[model samples]
Target: MSIAAGGFTVMEAEDDYVEYVPVAKRRALEAQKILQRKGKSSSLEEDPEKAKLAEAKPSLLVKATQLKRDQPEISPTEQMVQQEKEMIEHLSDRKTLMSVRELAKGITYSEPLLTGWKPPLPIRRMSRKQCDLIRKQWHIIVDGEDILPPIKNFKDMRFPDPILKMLKAKGIVQPTPIQVQGLPVVLAGRDMIGIAFTGSGKTLVFVLPMIMVALQEEMMMPIAHGEGPFGLIVCPSRELARQTYEVIEQFLVPMREAGYPELRALLCIGGVDMRSQVEVVRKGVHIVVATPGRLKDMLAKKKMNLDNCRYLTLDEADRLVDLGFEDDIREVFDHFKAQRQTLLFSATMPTKIQNFARSALVKPITVNVGRAGAANLDVIQEVEYVKQEAKIVYLLECLQKTPPPVLIFCENKADVDDIHEYLLLKGVEAVAIHGGKDQEEREYAISSFKAGKKDVLVATDVASKGLDFPDIQHVINYDMPAEIENYVHRIGRTGRCGKTGIATTFINKNQSETTLLDLKHLLQEAKQRIPPVLAELNDPMEDIEAIASASGVKGCAYCGGLGHRIRDCPKLEHQKSMQIASSRRDYFGSGGYRGEI
Candidate 1:
């Protein structure tokens, strides 16, 4: 019934147009300010007398001199741009993302205030060669020598032939831990809750099973053609939805090629054309991938129907919980039939989500491959203490020296822009991804980055979970995370699949007081070397890197101490968490009926 055995899938994406919503709006004002700054620089060059007077001022003289030392040799205007960017950073509250972008787009010395019109941005894409070159550089940096864990093959697993075909085409010969443990439960028509780290191939886990159900339906009604998907995939961000959509499309290719390929796909996300999206739904799609808010709009307009949905996959389930999508998610679940299959995937399971998962799944199976609350030690952690203004310089210098395929994680979207624009001005190959971008542009940014067209990706919490970047060599925490758990997941991007990677974080003086305390505790537990500032308040260190080493040492193969390997241990290896959680339903839904086999 499905071409999954061949690997191409019918997928979805925002068609094209994007709207300018305030929260999701691009900083047109900021972009205009930068342009004005440029114009001012030109004026300075044109007027020698004015330039001489400007440099004569004591404040300006010291700044120009500092800029000369801190930044790479560039034109005078470029220098001004760098200095202005630094000044603006101090003025931001660090509370909101849009504000950060506005701050980043500040004017040069020429234009004092941020008022002016900037042209609308046009679509842009990178050449394949440029992207391919970046992709190829990854193997050199990632470490996978100890990564010989057996690939989980569920060939004994039962599924429709269509799925088999799709897998063959996509080259997914084996299931990852997430796919292997989670799929069969779902295939048996049961709900599932999966908790694992990033880069664990979480996407394929639920995607393949949904494809199978679609395939099975096609077989029952051989000539039914594309009645479309019996599934809905709700994601946290547009970029992730687009990424998932593209991957799904790849799986749908053979179906389209085999005929009866009118399998429709629709995308509903903020900052994009809603009416057009509604039209696509009216035209009919087999599946819908969306952010919660946009879907609310679609449902309000009567353009989407969840009444027929028999299955749902929640990606980044924890993040969705964090983003306050509970009510929307509940609304989505309420629209589904009582016999629906719900699959929830997350990197870490907070108790709040555990309760929600229990409520949603009917006797669901819980799979834990990496163990409970375990940090993936594959990524090497590195740290530096510096002034807030120095961060712009530190990041640029770091990239120049160890520049490899890298992902930069920021505490917030504003910080994402701060790092993103700093890199752009320095001519570093980078792009930013956050909820702020319209759905289409977000998708484009991810595609371009994955294609290896980009060297560095500056992202906020958006990229912190449920993402895969197989060749990433480095993950930089531009600022330390407020939550210890986020730190565990953010750096995990690098050391995936047993590959060795590195993570670097910058801790500045102006960090929020509460966040700094939490960060200090986390670094201490990790057993990393804490800076001298905290030495007096800290306990005596048995090890040199007292602060960061506490949680970092690989549990003793013997005594479970970090310093010693298991080779010297006298005890046998022991397993941690149970492989599954007993998924028992509390009570049957009123007037519910079992699904037909």
Candidate 2:
């Protein structure tokens, strides 16, 4: 017997074989046969009647009109390729022109520092006495040579029209004290150490100048791939870094819409994928806002460079040193290939930070808006002796004292979570963020709180430094922090941007006497009502001026605490003990003499 399957003949017998084809192949063959039959039927010469019927009905396999052979249809992928090729050619021409300009100027493409930069004539023409009167009125103390006169109006700065418009849009009619003195110094390409209270618009002091610097560089020569970041802002925390990055973007957007050259800014922080940041760098960026850890990692990995980064800003410099990011920050300085303009802005100026600034900055100007580490006068401070066990329960009453968008700060991550959970269970709209939470969760909580979707935000010290929350009515310290600086920052969150705010701190006996004394002094300095518990704790540094003059440094020179002198600073002792323990550990690792051994 013989059998045929899919056009292949086979013999089925004692020594015969049969063959079969795949179902898909067989179906395709059947479809081809059908198409052949349809083609034969569709021929007008073969069947005129059927052809007329086909013309009346739409044919499935054939088109009524033929496509022109002169112009072929291009696939989406091919079109993209053509466009990319044209872009590459255009970029090449621009690069050639840039190279020629660089050669003529005897400078390299990576170095974009604008030498001999000067402020507008209006600023330069102001006499020293006039500058003094303005600074005195604003309570601004500037220590530097050839200080530029402070601009009373934003217009006097001679900023681009778009920036002025943006200022107007943001409802910032006049510059703050820091912006008044700090802006002119930085704009003049001078290194500066800016000391101002929290919520004093310090961010804008550096941010606006950074934008201007980036714009100047971009206009002079476009940034090529992996070539720039003319401006660099290093913040202590990821939240602060993101905030600064957003501010830069906010300014950049208007400039771009106003038909200015496109300037790119990137946020390089931990918890975000480094690949995305690397991709952005590979393209190019005009400004970079970053935290120390991630920025150091990127530089160490050679994924980014500061070759053209002439403008460097350190926001919350004291906090950066306190968080032990000082080494990472100094290491970053080693990566800069050229002389850079350094700016350090912080609410508190500790001895460590001052020493660090002296070593890092060159001929730096000191712009002090107020006494360093002093409480913000704009904030009304309230101290209550609430028991530690009853704080969570009393949190409800505190929330009521303020309107929506209140910040509750705790010393520990566990407290933040507990407070957050308790609030949620009690039907309070709240969000919590801490170092232990995932980055996405932290970002979500912050965003939700900022967007006014949540009434209260429970957070640790992570939100304390440099995270601006506009219109924050109150800041409640659930637990008094051990460090006075932390207390200052926690309260600073509410009283920001020239707005009056209230800060209520819950204190108990568990808090060290030193901390209590510091808080007492802070409250007294701000002229807030001090409770009996704090009032009874006698101030040890009654003759502070004498001590300050004797020590040649104001406050506790070691820790920047106003309540105690350097000799009595608990923080200094703790640091010394920590160093001793660390040394012991190293000695043990080196097989030194041990009692157990």
Candidate 3:
């Protein structure tokens, strides 16, 4: 039985339709058409006008069938139409406003997005309130320039003699601001919380202190029992731990050759040879850089001990929470007993982290190198509002302009893969990395990117934290992250270590109002001027003074006082008023009598 045109079921004699399925003629027709499109012959192709006949044929068994005939002659115009259809399908994958330069096998050039689509404008601007705060900094910068380190002088900090010598030989004279403020306290064994944007030389702040401690320990004490790592550095992910480990390794080598060195270390991360890690641990390493999970696993099995854990560092503390490794963090903290000095560094510190901070540290000195998620002043932030359809087109244009190293942030793993594949098909060099990618592969892609081998990297939030690719110039939000906090880490990839960088976000009308508002809040808090288009978009801060004054809001909790807070209250103000009242009473012979000194 066959379904002719106009939905008629034609039941053919079994003998006549011997080669066809007995009752699946309808299913077979469309299937056959596709096969013919691929240049393969099908039973239905033999009957050129059979589909149009609209005649029913009886079902048949053991029916003999004719082979398909050639397709109708295609006109040049029809061929053009077919070619265009294919192109449209290809272009569908490469949307406008999304410049997808995937970093796979070196970025391949994909034809940019549709013509005539304008690059998007930024979604929102920094608020006016934030703008005012920024202007104040310039004044302070000028006034303080004389008393503070010059920009170049930052690198020439008065580090300790040995550390200074090591830095000079390594050509690392100037300290990044994070290093400037953070290193001192960290080296002092003061538990510190470091909050700086990504790429702000935050690693060095902790690394320098770690080295100093390691050196001090080397000088004062003999090697500890077991291959237990003396210094424990924990991160959220394997890639980050490895990345940090490698970076610290470079600085450590020079120090090792020069002074109290011999700093053996164990890498305890998942997805590697466990026995090998254990062997290294058995050999007594100086530092153990690890992901929380593998470290916890080893500790649970009693594989290592922190009997000598003197210095502890948690990198990307916020990311550790995000990765659902909060328990592991607690365990890592619990594992290290005694009065070990600890350091926790994160790009942003939410309330939850503050809770963790309260539990982990002993009256730690807090250090905020930058506002949480604030755009680095050194980085240029460009906003472009683009429609999803036009995003790929804008991306292509953006890519053509600057082939600089770029970190592309996608909202999800699926999007990362889809965008990565589409860019690849479009001949754009790119690779997709999510939590899904194997650790080694992720490392390879990141390493390739950092080495200046890959032009673009498509990643999820994992790469947004603790990534130290200082040369990254453009951070393109192929899609805005749902969480505004992630936005801070994303742009932070560039403009790090005090280098100028650029961040461009593509927005469309469909861009969430809430997202733009949050972004505006973030940028404004960072002290950037709001884009004119979004000037009115910012919600004005409520006039809180009236509310404050009506209830004596400024009164100190410690003392029932007006015109002053108890803690920092000026005694002279009350004393001066009392004198005035007393003088008036004396002149009038009234009850008031106190006088100023």
Candidate of highest TM-score: 2
Estimate every model's Cα lDDT from 0 to 1: 0.60, 0.81, 0.62
Worst 10 residues of 1 by lDDT: 139-148
Q: Against the true structure, what is each candidate's TM-score?
A: 0.60, 0.78, 0.63
Name the lDDT value of residue 468 in candidate 2.
90
TM-score of 3: 0.63
| Local distance difference test, candidate 3 | 0.62
Q: Model 3 segments beyond 4 Å from truth?
A: 1-166, 169-171, 509-511, 525-597
Q: How displaced is residue 444 in candidate 3, in Å?
A: 1.5
- Which candidate gets the maximum lDDT versus the true structure? 2
Give per-residue CA lDDT, model 3, range 1-597, as digits (tens): 476867877776675544646667878888998877765224446665663452355334312322123456765545544553443344233322111222222332222111121111221143544433543432211111101121223323334455566666756767665565565456546666777667767777777666656666776775655744667898876777887787667667766666645777677788787899888777677888988778888888988887777788888876665555655666665565455677788877643354456444555666665445455677677777687888876777777645568888987788788777877887876766788777678778887877777778889887887777747878899887655567777888888656777788876666555456656655665567667544556442222224224433322211111222222323223434655876788899876421100
Return model 1's CA RMSD, one decimal.
32.2
Regions more than 4 Å wrong, model 1: 1-151, 159-171, 222-229, 258-262, 439-441, 509-597
